[model samples]
Target: MTPLAWLAIGLLVLVLLAIGLGAWRLRALSHRVGSFECGARRAGAAGAPWVAGIAHYGVGRIDWWRLWSVSIRPARTWSRYDLVIAGREPFVGDGPDTYLVRCRYHGQDFELTMSRAAYEGLASWLEAAPPGRRNVVV
Candidate 1:
C-alpha cells in the first residue's frame, strides 16, 4: 500500500476511536448524573420542532441538555419556583406509555414529552419542594 493510504487508514481508526470514547463518556455521565430522556418545545411558537434531550433533576432546578449535541453545558434550566404544571395528556405518535406535560415558566409556556415514569418523577420532585417555597400548580 502507498504511504498516503496508510495515513488515511490511521486517520479512520482515530476517528472511530474518538467516536467510541465520546459514546462511552456520554453513557457514563448519564448514569452518574441520573438523567432521563425527554422531548421539549415552545408551546406558542409557530413551526416549532420538538427537541429530544436529557433532563437532570438538580437541586431546586431541572437541567436539560440536547441529546445529540456534543456540548457539556445544559441548553436550558428551569427553576422549581418558576415552573408550574398546567396540565398533562397522552403524547400522540410516541407510544401509549408516553405523556405530554404542559407547563409555564415565568409566564412562558412550554411542553415536555416523556415516559409515564419520568412524568411521575417530575411531579414528585415538584411536590417535594420545601415548605414556604411550594407554589407549583401541578
Candidate 2:
C-alpha cells in the first residue's frame, strides 16, 4: 500500500476506536451504580444550560461527569456537608414524560437540573443527615 494509504487507514482506525470508546463509556456510565443525567449552569451562566453531565453519588459526595467527555474522572465533586440546596423548582421546557427539577446548591452557587426521581433521592439523602449538621434547603 502507498504511504498515503497507510496514513489514511491509521486515521480511520483512530476514528473507529474513538467512536467505540465513546459508546462504551456512555453505556457504562448510564448503568453505573449511582449515575443520573443532570444539567448544570454555572453561577455566572444563568438562563443558559451550559453543560449536561451525569451525577454519581458516592459515600459522602456527588461527582459530576461530562456526558460527552471520554475521561472517567469527574469534572466536579460536591461534598454532602458543603452542599445546601438553595431551592428547587420544576424545570421548564425539557419534556413531559421526564420532569426535571431545577435546584441551586448554596455553596457552589451553581444550578443543576435533574430528573424528579433524582431530586427526590437527593432530598432524602440530605434529610438523612446525622445530628449537628445545619438543615438543608430543598
Best by TM-score: 2
Q: All candidates' lDDT scores?
A: 0.84, 0.77
lDDT of 1 at 19: 81
Off by over 4 Å in 2: 96-106
lDDT of 2 by residue, 1-106 (tens): 9999999999999999998998888888889978888878766565566688888889888889888888978888887777877777766677643444434455
Global local distance difference test of model 1: 0.84
lDDT of 1 by residue, 21-103 (tens): 66875675578555788899999664789998889988889988877666778899999977888889898889999998999
**lDDT value, residue 32 of candidate 2:** 90
Top-scoring candidate (lDDT): 1
Query: Candidate 1 at 81: error in angstroms?
Result: 1.5
TM-score of 1: 0.80
lDDT of 1 at 114: 93
Please provide TM-scores, in order, for all candidate models, with all chains considered together: 0.80, 0.87
